[model samples]
Target: MSQGIEAADDLAPEIRQFHEAINSGYAAHPPQPGQTMADRRQVAERVRAPWAAGGPAMARTDELRVGPRGVRIRIHRPVLDRGLPSLLYIHGGGWMLFSLDTHDRLMREYAARAGIAVIGVDYSLSPEAKFPTALEEIVSVIDWLRQDGAGAGLDPSRIAIAGDSAGANMAVAANLLLRRQAKPLLDGMLLNYGAFDHAVTPSHQRYGGDGYMLNSAEMVVFWDAYLRGPADYEDPLAVPLRADLQGLPPAFLAIAGCDILADGNLSMAAALRAAGVPVVANLYEGASHSFLEAVSISPLADRALTESATWLARRLGRTCG
Candidate 1:
């Protein structure tokens, strides 16, 4: 291991490998000055491609256009069955980078492990889509599921939402929106190392360095790119930690102990508990942001996903395989 990886003693061996892979990928394709967003996205896709390959096989996979925005959604069903409880999964990437293709294996792992369908959304990215645009598309997908999920072999009444990082932020925000509209909320939430707020907590100082999958500086850029202006900082829908967490569904938070966002995730869990919401927070010590992507190699990542799958199965009113 290089000095950089070895110095990150807090990160698990597999997670360290994950970081190395990411760093090497980016190193091999260093960003050029004045690169377009499209260029950056291509770089991201190339870097993340290997991690998304070769996982549990699905009984069936289907693609469909959903909602007024014609948002593309990919559904992975573990077994051929009707009325399956489903998880509506949103991919992270600070609301800008990743896609359904990048999170393919992760979604399949969840579906196969939990014996449930996983619906991955290809929501619009930011800097072009802006705030509320992706959020609205997500809300639209939720609505579509309720109205037409049966046709997709999903039991709409038993659905849950899940995501990592920015995706996690939107999951909670979507629930909050449903609450405000007096609509029936989803069954549960599975939030993994979500960027809940823009606050610079102590965790940022401790783990926001370069080796971590995400850093404070990158977070600032991501938030800036996703939001329209300073006004969004004050919007509860944009910054979920600023919102009232009451009446939200039971949440299972896969908190990464060594992540820069750890403190914020902890705070979010506390807020959920204070609001009388049921919460199961499993803090994975020595893990960094995006550590779950190491499931292909890391036992820690595998254990975390297994625990989360069990929780989601129970929450969605089903039993894991």
Candidate 2:
């Protein structure tokens, strides 16, 4: 009995068509040798480029330099005259793929719908730069935001960190690091199909094969490419689910029922609740990983995005039209 449930029979044809197209593409270019992670990312970017290029126009794009990494950050503001809370968004790709460009539509949609400023970080990818690099880059960006986001038309004090998959892991880890260091506090977290634990859960064991999307073997490849060594797997920064959840900010977790990572999300929510952290976990039935990206065409996708945005708006104290 999830809060938002959209029956499969009610799905739009366009959404089904979109899913078919994606599946066809995946089948045609199944993950193979010589197809490096970079190649996979390029494929995703190409598929998403057209949609991104045609998305709602933004007020402007700005780059924020933190340390030696010239982080490419984009700011999407609402059309209204009033200022609003800011969200620091991290894009998902299992830490191996995707960028701000790949997630342009979703971020812009969130910014417009939530009536808040959205800041997307183009953090360095893995296989080239491994674990701790992404973590360090995210922390630096947050620090820069806390210090200078106000000048960029964002309210620094109301900043929240958000992301999907590996990005969500980074977001939660960044918050934990900030809490540990007594740094600037975040208002909350918006986690979508987050990969909080690398250890195979029951769901992973069940859906480890293809057809469900995001196969377990592919996930392992990503994990290997991102981590420095076996020891990193146990670190809280690498696996936030293992970290102490006490005193963390409130969280909104949207997990897909058919995803291999489902159980990990459920367990994380339970752990957070047990530790006294306010959490809202919604399991969307029949949805697969990365469903949020397919929302423009899929009815279930639309419902998930709507519910997530609504939750985010409530948490940020904003009203949607």
TM-score of each: 0.97, 0.89
Give me the overall lDDT of model 1: 0.90
Best by lDDT: 1
Kindly list the per-residue Cα lDDT of model 2 for residues 1-321, writing each as its tens digit. Answer: 001112233224444354455556545556678887677877777765654554456665555565356677877776544456888899988788878987888888787777788889888888899989988888888888777766766676788889998889998999888877888668889999888988888889765564555678878888898999989999997899999989889999999887789999999999999999999999987777777777666678777777878888888888963
- What are the root-mean-square deviations of the candidates from the true structure over C-alphas? 1.9, 4.5
In order, candidate lDDTs are 0.90, 0.78
lDDT assessment of candidate 2:
0.78
lDDT: worst 10-residue window of model 2? 1-10
lDDT of 1 at 287: 88
